[model samples]
Target: MPPTAHHPAAPPRLDLTDTLVLFDWNGTLVADTDRALRATNAVLTHRGLPGLTAEDFPAKWKLPLAAFLRDLGAADPEAAEQYWNRALAAEPAPLRRGTARMLDTLRACGARLGVVSAAGAAAVADDIRNTGLDDRFDVVLAGVAAKTSALLSQRPTRPRAYYVGDTEYDIHCARAAGYLAIAVTGGYRPAHALAAVRPDAVVDHLDQLPGVVTALHAKTPAPLGGTPA
Candidate 1:
């Protein structure tokens, strides 16, 4: 079985000023799965396709907005994107449970934080500002159609880095960028799907991040020059 949040890993006492931890938005940091599903269904219906049920949303979700649109049989992906954006923006999505605690814990540990998302730039910017988290992240990359390239550019020389997200594609991007891939459950993908991708670690909740960071720190080699990454 894959290692889970059930492991009694203690929070690290070491300062993590050199560690760079990046997170995916949407279902990972925000409790917006239902909101996303509503938007997707709206897009599908607009394209004359059958809407996906809540039960089917997880199975249908995928990265790179264009591909997801095509998978749903959208003939004009660009038009479908506009439909999705308007639908998603109709209501505000709340932060995921334990989001504040997890951010606080990681910040207290002195880790540099960032958010990398495939969502629209305007929507992501509005959400961060609305949630009062605009100042929290060191970097925020939104509307990232080419995620692996964008992520690689963000950490060109950092020795030890981590990317936490809710999907298998996120794990693939992390691996491509040479960051430790940490998958969180209860998001867009199920534990089984995420496990098949072989992320370095998996957790059930965001609050378990401190322990995950602590555990990863012990395993990652110490960075050269001892400077903040």
Candidate 2:
């Protein structure tokens, strides 16, 4: 079941002087849903599996990606890897709306930024470079099979840490890693789908992110096994 929102009023405003904000790649920071779907369908056609519609893609998409491929009839890791390679070879997706502004705002406000994604490191790095966002992030951790493990490895204790993403999986990963979860609606999933995951908050645009992060950081950090405040 989706967790209920703990705060229903306007998102509070506060300082985020030394916070670390981590982002997911595909649907979070990059507007790649269309390109991703096209690549996915191409792979499906090549593998003799049924292709998915745009609506079906978000509702059914899963992470580690290999699991999604296996469900689509990929027999082994090598087969899934081939499909992933093909997807990467497809035209790159554009940056999401307000992505650059958001990064710049956070940087100017003294927040540390990073990316932790399941996409290949080389591919993500290349995209970051091409998009002119290379200097914005302090770390770019990619090819992550499970975000929770990666989060733990980077920051064992989640003080002033936040994970901004677009899926229920991202919310789960954030919660498991003890980081504040912020979901944006402009990604692959719709607003309601993101709300179902019960992140700390959900915003319709990236421009609203700074306020949400500030508010969450002002409150007491949620304990390891407790709900966020």
Q: lDDT tens digits, residues 1-229, model 2?
A: 3233333222223334447789998889888888778877877877777899988888877776778777767677557655675677456778888789878877777767889998777778778887899899977899887899987665533246888888888899988887778887767777777777778877766777776666665575543332221
Which residue pairs collide, candidate 1? none
Q: TM-score of each candidate?
A: 0.92, 0.85
Model 2 backbone overlap count: 0
RMSD in Å for candidate 1, one decimal? 2.3
Residues 43-110 of candidate 1 have per-residue lDDT tens digits of 98877899998989888788888789888899888778767877887778889888877777677777
Error of 1 at 49 (Å): 1.3
In model 2, which regions exceed 4 Å deviation? 1-15, 156-158, 221-229
141 in model 2: Cα distance from truth in Å? Answer: 0.5
What are the per-model C-alpha RMSD values against the true structure? 2.3, 4.6
